[model samples]
Target: MLSREIINLQVGQAGNQVGESFWQDVLAEHGLDQAGIYHGTDPVQLQRVGVYFAEVNHAGSQSKYVPRSLQIDLEAGVCDRVRSGPMGGLFSPETYLHGESGAGNNWAKGFYTEGAELIDPILEVVRKQAEACDVLQGFQVIHSIGGGTGSGLGCLLLTKMREEFPDRMLATFSILPSPKVSETVVEPYNAMLSVHQLVETSDLTICIDNEALYDISIRALKVNSPNFKDLNGLISKVMCGVSTSLRFPGQLNGDLRKLGMNLIPFPRLHFLMPSYAPISDPKTQSYQGTSVPELVQALFDRRNLLVACDPRNGRYLTAATIFRGNVASREAEVAVRELQTRNSNQFVEWIPDNVSVTLVSVPPVGQKQAAVALSNSTSIQELFLRTHETFAAMYKRRAFLHWYTGEGMDVMEFSEAESNSQDLIAEYQQYQEARAGDEDEYDEEEAPSEGFSQ
Candidate 1:
């Protein structure tokens, strides 16, 4: 079978740094060195390498593997650092795009002024990258919604991709802003605006919260002061785990489209929360092999979620659990079924077989087993509710209004975004409170939900 290629777009400072960490792990997993040269003799490692890399041969040099990715930022600092970094040569020089000034943490500059100016060139490069593929699958974007370039321009690119390639899948690893680790004061505004766009543009959105990363680092990894590298490493692991089936041949292989189909029940409610299990500090030497039942329990544990929402608070609409490593299919099936049967109330009763299990033979580099769960639960509304409250607090006073309006944005747009976000939150609430035969009752009226205060 031919490999289905995916193009990766890393936008803004946060996106580029996270992308670097993800590539480092992917290269190691595929047995490729920093210069994209395959040093390992494992043919299985390189069999499906083309999924995320383009095999290239230079004059009189060994075959070099280049990542099918684009590094973009409104400012040149992040891209410059990546180019001069250790894994610099792994990416093509033409794939980097930058501007003179940064986005100043304002969404208007990224989406309208600075980001708008660069969209054409970015799409052109994307077109060239797609032309190099034998079977193009889709595009994955890694970005943060707190900053100007990542939030504004990242969303702008998504809308364009939908227009240019309507049939292709669009997925994102979105770093949402948290009150605990906010870099700027306007993070809520940026996040709300980004979520509004994501609801309309992205096919699949993987939510990652800084607060959750911090909790994992402090509790699981035993880190005192976790930096961006530590947080990005955790995200990279989940990203790899999510793509394990696509990157390697497995009995239960799944792709981006398959994941979306299973996890997403409703079109507008595509936000997914990802959880990874058996996460421990690297300083600890001894790695224990976790059983299938224990692994399933850990995957559902709120402490292990990449986002800071509790699944118990909201019912699960659908879930996809991907296991990587050597494990018996019967064990996995029974474990998941047992879990579902034991906690049937946690899932919506209407959907039959709400939980999906996929197993891949190859494990991570230094682990006996790894499992990642993508859950489309109503509890994700907690995140949206948090951002909406903050945005409302600031928007009521017209704070930071001039910055966006100066960039040719209308004040009405903010209101519209707020309303759209409220509708999304309400829709999730409606389905969450929905029961098996009570679906017709929710179709009566579309009133604002007062229960969102929780």
Candidate 2:
């Protein structure tokens, strides 16, 4: 069996403190085995994974400006391991504005401190680590594409890695910002463009949306914490969940090569809204808006099996609202119908038009509940299957869209070819039987026990 490895790189201000805390909490909570830290300059040996940390140089910095740093930590060590890594490598925008524009860097500091300088160093560190790893001959590398440092420098690093180690499986977990945040529109798009540039070079790219998580968090817990302390914790939990689902012995599927698959997993929130009915009691009938209890109940009702299974993946049902407005219901119904049509094959879109509803999807890296839930087997497995089906359906749907729009060759041709490639009918039948047997056993175990009459 091929062993899996994780190489973590720290970039920008977020990576310095908040990001680190989140990752540590996640690892500890999940009881993941820790590997040695991949100090950027060290040679990679040993049959283990490494977590590396580096600081990116934002434009504003003294002479000793470092763009980003990479570290590799095994699954066993305490959270304190992150502190031993380098600090102060990030390049803020202030440094560049003073150097090139010849203005008081502080004035343009916050606006221009894009951390562009760290791009090269980040790439260098990644390349060096890849070269040092003897065991990395067939290993895959997964990283993120979001945040100031990770999204910017990380993308460049991915490009460099692709050129240096063409054979390695390079996958990225790209984070999409929440719509409520100003950066949501441009940052994710930039990250996507970076991914697109290296798409053909890498094995696969997985996209995660921060907006979804934020919405869910606010709606479900009635709290909106954006600090790295909170956000990173959520993301770490999510990463741990995905890693566990693929690596845990009980969760593995014989037919799937977990190590070979280049997956980008993210969190999504689904919400449900029920139509409100007037109270029969003459005193309470005056209420026209949704009740708090009703909204809470709706959120719980729409919780996906996947979130319970893999909290780390950030797949959960957050909140639900009941709206009595006709306009709101009609608009929601239309949107839900469109989404259902789009994802008809794999997911059942359950949103109704006449209900006031909003679903939020958040990255689980910083979520507390999700982090705690990662160790549970039942929860992880359910999430694993749900995510698999969701992605598969998405891929198929996108292909169909491409084919229909004349952007690519007819997918039907490929489907027909796959159908005739082997005895799919027989294989499918066998698969169904096996699935049925497994379900039967599960049902038998879950069935109410027979006992003396109560």
Candidate 3:
């Protein structure tokens, strides 16, 4: 299978330098102290992956501009290398940032601009590597979905890659800017739209907020420098956390095709939280609904909220609903119940067996994240009882459904149909021979390969 990681750096902007520092910090966090050493080393095989740097032309005031030096660090030692075939030519689209008109003029500007021609060479290299593999695999593309270059261009590139390599799995790690530093109205909306587009095409999309990461750095590490180095280090650590968790040897490889066999396409739901705050009590607790808002804020404070979603799926959530058990305070329980009832009346509709609901309860950090799935159940007790066996039990139900109804099932059914069709044709030939009184039976020879395999 093809396994690759493609990181798009915002070369011309301050974020580009920040990204470098992020990478360094991540390496340091993982205990890899050598400078530039992390780029060449494979996380799985622990070898050097060839790193290549390319020059991309960023947009200026005029239509044509001088190219800036942006680098793509590829770990070639990894199993799946980017191919050099038809798929490689897919990233040949220009990246442009769109801005709001009139009042938002100051808030809008091009982050990075590049003609389609500039991406051609990079894609060509990817195509060549992909074509040589027997089974095209998984890819992790990292870049910020903020400002111009990373958001606009990165989304376009992801869309093209998805179109070209439909069979292979792809995931994107997007960095979001802090609301305070953002241009407020326009930039946030632009970034959100860009990310939405990328998520629709990708298998899984992971988001890291710059504000959250920065807070962690300042509070936890006491890093005072606001320069690119420190900022980049924080971003890199977040990326590394995700990359390490998903691709670590013991962890299930985060290939969507493989994941599809055991889990539903992660539902697409937008998680809206008020904002970040300082944590007064570092101690963790199982708070009820009355305190859920504070708990969520605290979770955000720790920068530990991990949200995964598939935008292509039709699962839209308009409001938040919290559920608490006996561990929660009485006030918290009452508050949660009231909120759920209110939300149920306003936003939720009770569909029959068609819809599945998942309730994941994250325990105090030292414990595991508890998850329960409910279908057509009125009380939480029934849902919890059904899902109480183990973490795998909760996923198993979803996995079975995904395998039977999702694309995974479709692919298998299609293959079976082709096999049956071939069998029918062969039988028809045999029947015709019998009718014509022919004694010999037909025998088929192995087909020759033209470098491509079915």
Candidate 4:
């Protein structure tokens, strides 16, 4: 069977850096080097890995197939550095798009001018990539909401992707700025626009909080000062676990479509929080094998959650537990049945039992077992609360309004976007309240839950 071809469009410095490490993890998973040259000989397995990348050179050319990743940035230095780096051969040189002047952490600069100027060139590259695929399903974008290029240009790209290829999927791996840290004074302003666009566009948007990531690095990896390289590598591992079902077929939910079907019931409730077990880094800490029950329990712990949240307090609309790497089917069923009894972590009674358990025997690299859970929880309400609070504090005083207005963005758009952010938060809050009030009625009806197929 042919694997689904998905293009990866990494925008800005944060995006490219993250994609570099992401492909590293993917190459390792497929038994390939940093340059993406496959080490295996199995015809079927090789093609499966190839599905995720594009062969840059001709059929017989020296340049091997690289991940179909388009590295875009407002500044040229990062691209130049990557081209001269050890893995330069892994990517097509022509795919890098850049400009002389940077976006300067201003969303207006990126969206109105920089991103707009590069749209034609970026689209050209995307068009060529689309032409190469036998069945081009969609593209995945990676960037942060704190900076101009990553937040502003990233949103512009997503908006265009949605407009041009309305039929194809657009999944965004968005890095959320730390609520406590001051990345830039204008970050609050940038995040408001970026997140609003994410909510308006994109099919599946996974919010990876920088705060949560940093916490994990310090606690799990024992890193004194976790740099981008260290943090990105850890995030890449989670992406690998998330992509396992997409790259390899084993049990149910092996395809990207199923991932959306099983997890996303509503469009706006598309915020997915990923949690991967065995959080320890092998270099800093030992790789320990854990029981199915222990792994499942860890996923429930918010400390291991990719998004910073008190999940025990948040309401879950739907959840999926993906147990990969030699996990037994019976063990998976028993684990879910057990996790369900801990209603302290379970869904409200009124809503259907929406916990899904997908058990696949395929193991991740250098490990015998692993588990990742994608939960569509209301904890994102808390997530948005932080962004909105920061944004509102700035917007009320019209702080940094000129940065956007000067770049052709309407001043009112900020308020509108802030309103949009508040609406999603309110929606999640409402859902949490609905099931509780409707619980008695649901109980009287004796309806079957749309939960675990085990």
Off by more than 4 A, model 3: 1-113, 132-136, 183-186, 224-226, 245-248, 251-454
List lDDT for all candidates, in order: 0.90, 0.32, 0.34, 0.80
Write candidate 2's Cα lDDT for 238-311 as tens digits: 44444433323321221112322211121111111111122122233344344333333332232311122223
Cα lDDT tens digits for candidate 3, 1-454: 2334333333224334444444443334322333222222434323212111122333443111111112331111110111132222212222211222211111112212241323455455456545544444555555655454455455555667777887666655556655544543334433543544653676654455556555555554466544445555445434443333232333123333433222222232111221122222223223323244443224222243222111111111221222212223343334334433433322122211122111222121122221111111111111112112221233334333232232122334323423333343343233222311133332212211111000
Which regions of candidate 2 fall more than 4 Å away from where they truly are?
1-4, 13-19, 26-124, 137-149, 184-192, 224-226, 245-454
lDDT of 3 at 2: 32
Compared with the true structure, the alpha-carbon lDDT of candidate 2 equals 0.32
Shift of residue 139 alpha carbon in model 1, Å: 0.2
Model number with the top lDDT:
1
- lDDT of model number 3: 0.34
Clashes of 1: 0
RMSD values for the candidates in order, in angstroms, are 5.0, 17.6, 21.1, 2.6
* Tens-digit lDDT track of model 4 for 69-108: 8889999988887778877778887788987798999999
lDDT of 1 by residue, 333-421 (tens): 78887777677777777777778888899899888888999899999999999999999999999998999999999999899899999
Error of 3 at 365 (Å): 21
**lDDT for position 210 in model 2:** 47
